[model samples]
Target: MSSLTMMPMSLEEIAQAVQGRLVAGTAAANTPVATSAFTDSRQIVEGSVFIAIAGERVDGHDYVPHVGAQGAVAAIVDHEIADADVPQIVVEDTVLALGLLAKHNIERRRALGTPFTVVGITGSVGKTTTKDLMKALLSHMGSTVAPVGSFNNEIGLPLTSLKVNAETRFLVAEMGANHVGEIANLTSLVPPDIAVVLKVGVAHLGEFGSAERIAQAKSEIIHGLVPGGLSVLNANDEHVAAMSAFAPGDVMWFGLPNGDGGNPAITAQHVRCDELDHPSFTLKNGDGEHAEVTLGICGQHNVMNALAAASVAMRLGMSIDEVASALSDVTTISPHRMAVSTVNKQETSFTLIDDSFNANPDSMKAGLDGLLRWKAGSESQPFRIAVLGTMLELGPDEKDLHVGIGRYALEGGVDALLTVGSASDASLDALAGAMADGASLAGDASHVDWVHDIDEADRLVTRLAVEHPGAVVLLKGSHASGLSALAERWQALAAQ
Candidate 1:
C-alpha cells in the first residue's frame, strides 16, 4: 500500500517538481507507477498522492496530518501551504488536480502505442455489476485491469487508470457521477477507447435535480471517448436511447425486445430463467446465429447487465458464442443485485429477495417485479412481503422516489410490506393510503404489514417464515439500512 509503489512513475519524474509542485520526480521516460495510487485518505498508503478535497462530510485537508504521517510522497492541496516538511503540490482544486495527474500518468502509457485499451461504462444503476462482468470477460481474453468494486469516482477512476500500462490489454473503468463536474473529470482522465451506458433511471434524481439532468451527467462517458470509439447502449433505457444523439462515434444497442426494428444490434431471445428468475437465453444478431447462455446467478435485472456486457464484447470482436460461453460459467459477484434468496434450515426453506445494496425508484420496482413473479409461480408460497429501508443521500426527491417504489410494490404484487425509518415510512404510508382508497393493488390487502424498525421487521420475517412454511420475502434498502444483517440472520437460520 506504499504510495511510492503506486506512483513509481510519478515519483521518479518529479524533477524536484514534486518537492513543491505536482511535477515528475525523476527524469526517466515512461516511469513506472506504483502498485496503485489513490487520493482518498481513508484508503491511503505510503507514497500515495494524497489529494485533499473538501467533501460533504469531511475535508481531506484536515486529515493531511494523518496522510502525511502515513508516508504519502506528496499532498495535492487547493490551498497554498507553508508546511515546509510536507511535499505539498498546490493546485487550484484537489479533485481537478487528481484528474490532471491521472491523465498525465496515462498519456505517458498511451504514447508507446501499447496494447492498452480503455473501456468506460456509466449509468444510474448496475455500473458495478456491469464492470465486474466486463472484467470477467476481458480477463479471459487478456491481462485486464478494472476498477475495484464501486471505485468509479474521481479518486477511484484515476487510481484505476494508473494501473493500466504498456502490457495491459484491456482497461475497464466504471464512471459514476453525482454532479456534472464529476463525470467530466473522470472521463477526461481515462479517455476510453470504448464506452457503454448500461441503463439510466431516476436513482440520483435528487442530486442532479431531475432525470434529464441525471441523463446528461451519465452521458458524459462519451465525452472522452477515443475518436471513432464505439458506444454500446441499452435501448430499453430511455435515458440511454437519448445518448445516441450525443455520441461522437459508432453506436450499437442491445435490448430484450427486438421490436426497436433497427434489428436491435443484439437481442436476447427466448430468455428463460429458473424459478428464481435468473435469466438464461440465446443472443441473436443480424446473422440469425444463436449462442446459448445460462447465467450462473439468478435475476432478470442481472440478465440485462449481462446483455449490456455482451454488447461491448460484440464490439470488441468477440463472437456471439464466445460472448455467451464466457458469461455462462463465470461466477457473478454478489452485492451487485439479484431476484430472490432462499434460506433453508434442516426442515423448511424460506425465499427472500435481497436488492439491498442500494435502491432507487426503478431498481426497486424491478426487484419487486422479480420477487412477485417468483411468489406467483409458487402458489403455495406462504407470504409475499417486502422489507424496505431508506434510500439515503437523495437530497430533495427522496420522498417522491421512495413513494414511487412503494407504488411499484403495491402494483408489482407484493402481498405484505414492512418499512423502516421515517424516510421509508413516507413510502410505506403512500402504499397503505393508496390501498386504503381501494385502488386495485397487487395482492391481498389483509396481508399488509408495516414495521417501525429492523428488529421489529426481523421478528415478523422469522415468524412469517416459520408459520407460512413457504414464502417469498424481499429485503431492500440503502447501504445504511442494515438489510444485509437481516440476510445474515436468514443465512444463519438456514445453516441450522
Candidate 2:
C-alpha cells in the first residue's frame, strides 16, 4: 500500500500553507516534513503526513493516533487530539486544507518559472483511457504527472496536482463528476492551460437528472480554463462539439471528419480493426498531414481517445509523426478496460476481454460492440459469451436501459448470454431480469441464463470455458456488479 513518493516540505511550511495552527508536539519548524501524505492509517509510510478525512462509515479523526504511532511526521485533523504526541496541524476543515496545500504546491512550482503545462480532461467515459494516452504522448516531451487511476474528484485531483514539482513539466488531470459544479470546484483548485472534453454521456444520470445536465457539467471545465488556454474537443459528439462556443481561447477538434470537408485539426481516417478488434488508422491533421497508426490496444472507441490525446500533444508542439509513434506504443495502462488476455484451461484457451472495471449505457454498448467486432474478423470461429452484470447509477430508466442492452446483445449475435444479480425490487425490474428477459424473448430461451450473484457467475464462467474451447468472454458492468473480481478469478484460474 505504498503511495507515490513525493517531495518533502518542512513542517512549518505545510502548516502555513494550509493556514492551520501547529497546536501540539515539539517538532522543530525546520524539520524536512513528511515524505508524502496519507489518508488511511494502514497506508502510512515512515515520515508521512496523515490527513484525517471525515466519512459516514469511518471517521479518519479516530485514526490520528494510529498513524502517529506508525511514524507519521504530522497529522492534519479538524479536531485537536490531546493524547497524540505527534505535531498536529489543527484546521477548521481538513479536506479544504488538503486543497489549499495542493494549490500552494502548484504556486511554488510556478514561482520557479519552469516550463510547466497542465492539461485537464473531463468526460462521461474514456476519461481514464484518454488520460493514459495523454500521459504516454506527453511523457515523451517532459516529466509528466497524471492521476493514478480515476483520481479526478476534489480529493483525488488535489492529491494528483500536489505531485507536481520543479522538475515536472506536464500535468494531466482527469476530472470526473457525479453532479453539477463538481468539476468547476476541482478546476478552481488546478486550472488547466489546456482542457480536453471527450464526450458527455448518461454515465451518472441518476445523480444529474438528465443528459443536458451532464453536458452542462462537462462544459464547466471549459469555463474554468486559464486565460487564452486551448480546448481539445470531440467533433463527433454534438454535446461535446457544442462546447466550442463557450471556449474563451482557441479550440482544436478531433474525431472522424464528416468529409463535407469539415476537416478537424486532428482526425482518424481509413479506420479499420483487425480480427482481434485492434484498430489501425491514418492520423490526419488539418494541414493535410497524416501518418498511419496501428494501435496496440483493442476497441474502436479508443480511436477517438487516441485522437483526443494526439490533438493535445500536437498543440504542445509534438509533430504528427511523434504523436503517432507514441500513441501506437501505448498498450492498456489501466486494467479491465478493453484488456485482452488469454486464459487457458488444460488443453484449450479463450480470449478474455475484461472491460469489467466499470460500466454505463454508453460504455456497455462500446464493450459489446468491441466484443462483436473481435469475433467478426477471427479466422477461427469463437463463441462470443457476454456475461453482463448490473450497470448502476441510471436513475429511473435503469430497467429500459438494461433491457435495451440485452436486446442489443442478442442482435449482436452473442452466443450463450448470462446475466447476474436478482430481478428489480418490484415487477422484477432488476437489471439482470430485464437483460435475461430481453435475450430470452429475442432468441431461444436455451441460449440465455440468469445467475443470482457473482459467485454463481464465476462458477458458470468456469463451466463455459471448459465447454466452449476458444470462446471469447466479455465481462462488462459497474463496480457494484463485481464482474471485475470475477475477471480476476478467471485470469488466476487460467494462470494455474
Candidate 3:
C-alpha cells in the first residue's frame, strides 16, 4: 500500500481540528504528524494518530498502549488515557471525532489550491464495483484514491477520505447506508464534485421500511453534493432517474438502450455476453463518440456499472477511447463479486462463480443469470448448481423474496439448488427451506435441498463433484450466510 498523502500537522493543530483537549505528553504537542489517522491499532505507523472507538465486543481504548508502543504520536479517545506514553486528545465521541478529522483533511487539501475531484457513489447495489471501475478509469489521468472493498459506511468512508492530500487528483468516495441520513453525514466530510447514483433497490428494506424510503435515502448523496456538482444516474431504474429532480446542478444518465427512442447520455449498444458470460458492447456517448468495450470482467449486469464509471471519467476530461481501454484492462474487482475460478477436487475440476460477498433479491437474480450464461468446454451434458444463502433485510416480504429467487432460479434452468443456513438460527434455516420449497413447487423436489450449515453444504457439493465431473457451481449470499468462507475453502483446496 502507498503511504498516505495527508499533509503534516502538529498534534495541537489536530486537537483543535477535532475539537478535542490535548492531554498527556503535552510536550509532544508540537510534534508533526508523520502519517494519517487509523482506527485499527495494528495498522498504526510511527507518528500516526489512533482513534479509539468503543464497540460492543471490544473497546479501542484497550489497544491504546499497544499503539503507543508502535510509535503512534497520539490517540484520540472519548476519555483520558492517563498512563499512555503518547499524547492523548480527549473528545466526547471518538467516531464523530474521526469524521471531523477527515473533514479537516479534505479542507486542508482544498486550501492548497490544487486540482482535485471527489466522486461520491451511493446506491442499493453496484457501489463497490462502480467505485473500483471509477478508480481504474481515473488513475489513467492522475493519482486516485478509493476504498479497498465496500468500505462505504460512516467509519469506512472517513478512513478512506483521510488518504487524500494536495497531490491526489481523484478521490472516489463510496457512500452506503442502512438507514436515512447516513450518506448525508458521509458527504458532509468530503462533499463530492460528481455524485453517482447507480440504482435504487431493496438491499436494506428492513431498515428503511419501503422502496420509496430506500430511494429517499439514496437521494441524500445528490442532495449532499457540493454546489453546482454533477449527478450521474441510471436511466433504466425509475427510482434513480427520478432523483434527477433533486440535483442542484446538471444530471447525466447512463444505462442500456430502452429501445423506445430514448437514450441515456452514456449507454451500451448491441450489448451481448459471450459463452463465458463476459459482456461485449459498443460504448456510446450522447455526443456520438463510441468505442468497443469487451470487459475483462464477467456478468452482463456490469454494463451499467461500466457506463457509470465512464460517465465520471469522461466528465473529468478522459476521452471515450481512453476510458474503454482502461476499463478493459480491469479483469477483476474485489473478491467474491462474480469472481470466476476453476477449482479441482479429487482431480475433477469444476467451475466456481463466487458472488458471495453480499446478496439481495436483485443481486441474487443477477448471479443466477450469470450462472445460466456459463457454457462448458467439451462436456456434452454439464450440470449447473446454485448454492444460494439467505437474503436478509427485505422488510416484511423477506420470505416472499427468498421464494421468488428460488422459483426464478429453477424456472430459469438451474439444474440443482442448495440453500444454506446456520442451524443456530432457526429463522434463517426456515427461510432457506422456503427457498427449497419454492424450487420444489417450480420443478422437482429431489433437485433442491436446504442444508443446516457450511459443513453439510460442503459434503453435498463434494459428493456432487464426484457424481458430475464437470459441473458449474455458483455461491451467492450475504456475508452472514458463510458462503464466501466456503468459496475460500474450496479455493484454498484447489491451490494445494
Highest lDDT among the candidates is held by which one? 3
Q: Across residues 1-496, which tens digit of lDDT does each residue of candidate 1 receive?
A: 2212332455435323223354323342234233445667777665566777798998878876666577566666777455423455666667666667668667766777767778898998888888888888887777787877688887778777766655677878899988876777777677888889987777766678877888888888886788888888888887888888878888988888756456566788888766666678888865677788888765677777888888777767788888888887766564536634578754456776677777766676777777776735554655677877666656575665565666567766666777665435565444333332231334455555545567778777777767776777877777666677777777676556
Q: How many pairs of residues collide in each model?
A: 26, 1, 0
Q: Which residue window of length 10 is worst by lDDT in model 2?
A: 421-430
lDDT of candidate 2 over 322-418, digit per residue (tens): 9989888998778889888888765567889999989998898999999889758557778888989888878999898888888889887888788
Please give, for residues 246-342, the per-residue lDDT of candidate 3 as tens digits: 7999999999889899999899999998888898999999899999999999999999899999999998999999999988999989999998888
lDDT comparing candidate 1 with the true structure:
0.70
Q: Which is superior by TM-score, 1 or 3?
A: 3
How would the candidate models be sorted by lDDT, starting from the highest? 3, 2, 1
> How would you order the candidates by TM-score, starting with the best?
3, 2, 1
Model 1, residue 135: distance off in Å is 1.0
Against the unseen true structure, what C-alpha lDDT does each candidate score?
0.70, 0.85, 0.89
Estimate candidate 2's alpha-carbon lDDT, on a 0 to 1 scale: 0.85
Provide the TM-score for each candidate, comma-separated: 0.82, 0.94, 0.98
What TM-score quantifies how close candidate 2 is to the native fold? Answer: 0.94
